[model samples]
Target: MFQETVQVLERLLRSPSQIAKHCAADEDPRALFLASLCATLLGAAAFGGVLATSRGGLQLLYSATKVPLALVITLVLVVPALHGLAASLGQPLRLSAVVSLVLAATGRAALVLLALSPVVWLALDRGIGYHSSVLLAAACYALAGLSALGLLWHGVGKSLRGAFVIACFGLVLVPTGAQTAWLLRPFIGRPAQARVPFLRHRESSFADAMYLSALSSQGIYRAPEPNSHPAPRGATNLADDAEEAP
Candidate 1:
């Protein structure tokens, strides 16, 4: 199993275009699906290890869950949209193929994330600060996503009614992913906190989180003070620290 997995990984990483092309040619979509799924899960695990540094082992487990949840959320939202578009455009609309292609694309993104893990580890270890780390992680994810889109286009554009639908799906996918990740917050540990929580309060919108991160990074925003007492488990507290010199 290990050897076969290695071979699959090598092929996908070395020739993602070829693997994508083969998958598009109907060479066992399930194989591609499994390969991509494993790749994504493994990549997420590596990221989880990095998060373990500041967030603790419990949060590391939570971090591992992010990509899978994000993947499911994005696919659930984007797949139907793509299917409907394909149907309306009189495209063949092979649902399985589309799904496999998407998986491959995202898996490639995960591979990129794996490659980026070292850099992220360095940033986290060297103390790049909360907002900068968030921005960096977001930028890496965005780059990976764009690369994935390009791979998807290369793999399946020949069959689609142009690649316009792929772009359209991206419009929905990006926000869906961000919101989902927001809902599953604290992937990276907060400065003043220790224990991780599940299903915390939704005090702010996703836009607010990103904006505050940016503002706080620039020293323009003053986050309210944390209570002297310990925060309860499952409580959400994302307020930035005013004392830390950014």
Candidate 2:
């Protein structure tokens, strides 16, 4: 089992074409799905826990659980859209095949995230400010997303229509994934937070939070709204709602 898992991870990073063919043929799909699912859950959980190291305590557990949950939910929501998009673009794939392909791509991304976990943890440990930490995490996510896109591109086919389909899928994916993660925010709790909450009340959209984070990272914070609650000492002063992970 360990050897097989290692082989799958290696193929995910180094031989996406072969993995794509396996998914397209639906060969031993149950085994493929199980392996990819395990990779996704474990990798995402590890990275999430690392992200929470900035704000230790129950946050490690909360972030670890929520990150995998977010990924699973995002996959559930987007797989059908990917199937439909591929079909519409004349790259029709069996729904099961599509599912396996997507799971593999996401698992690949999770592995990338896991690889980045230590770097992010080190940055947080070095006392990077909250806004900079958020930006750093976002950068790591973008890098992982790119890794996933490579596998997905191969799975769909390296042709023109496949490129179009993947592009369309990405458009749907970015916002959906972002909103899902945003809805389950506080992955990196404020360092000065009195108590860690499993979730935060939805204030702004993911796009808004990211935009604000970018500005805050540059030391240009948004003014607080009238009658808005004050932010915690170590939180970004973005309308009293600190931007969380992307």
Candidate 3:
């Protein structure tokens, strides 16, 4: 019944006014089933892929309810698309085609989920903690896998393969982004080392001055500051200057 309904929906979405002319709005129960199934399968495949490959603190969340998350996305996105396909197929909602395809697609979705199962282990293998730099990969892979799964089930429906691949590419972006962010983090809080080039030179000099002044204050040197020159801005240098002068 669900499969039959989806076929009708596929026709309806493909060509809505035509379907409306012949079929009542509430005509098919199978349509709802197919819609729900597509949603479930695609959503599961999408999120499950992420759970399977992602490492880091977020892995826990991704892994825990990945299928359900996939299920939700399927309901929200995939089903509507299927409905659109049905509305335009130019045929009566055929039960056999609907059933066969839905079953095939759902089976593929399950396979994708299975394929995605390695994420947590893979992440841990890399020695990264969850919720750290690697979490984005997991999230991205999951989303990508769903699109891929949809394309696979639908047999190259409207750039599905490309879209899926693009989503997977999105995973690539996360790690690169994380590494870039990590590399650039020092500049954000930089205590001399991360300072801008010109600022780094000034900060380095200030650090050296501060270090010398501290040593002198601890009686580790004759003077951290020169008695002949005005004391530097650091408080430790002022003390050293007075001590050396007197």
Considering every candidate listed, which one attains the maximal lDDT?
Answer: 2
Order of quality (lDDT) = 2, 1, 3
**Pairs clashing within candidate 1:** none
Global lDDT of model 3: 0.37
Better of 1 and 3 by lDDT: 1
Off by over 4 Å in 3: 1-63, 89-107, 129-246
TM-score of 1: 0.82
Please provide, for model 2 over 106-214, each residue's C-alpha lDDT reduced to its tens digit, 9 standing for 90 to 100.
Answer: 8988989999999999999999988888888888888888888788899999999888998999999889888888889888888798999998875656776687778
Model 3, residue 7: what's the lDDT?
Answer: 65
TM-score of each prediction: 0.82, 0.92, 0.31
Give each model's whole-structure lDDT: 0.66, 0.83, 0.37
Task: Give per-residue CA lDDT, model 3, range 1-246, as digits (tens).
Answer: 656656654543354233332322344444544553564455444444344343224333333344444333332334334334443543223433333343334433343444444653465357553223133333433444453344323332335543453344334433332332222211111112222221111222223333454555455654443543342455433323220000
- Give the per-residue lDDT of model 1 (tens digit) for 1-246: 566556767777787678767666767555567778898878866765565466566777767776566666675677666666656766545777677767777778888888888998888889888778777778777877887777666655544554876677677778777877766666776656755675454545566567667777776664423552144334333444211100
Residue 199 of model 1, lDDT score: 44
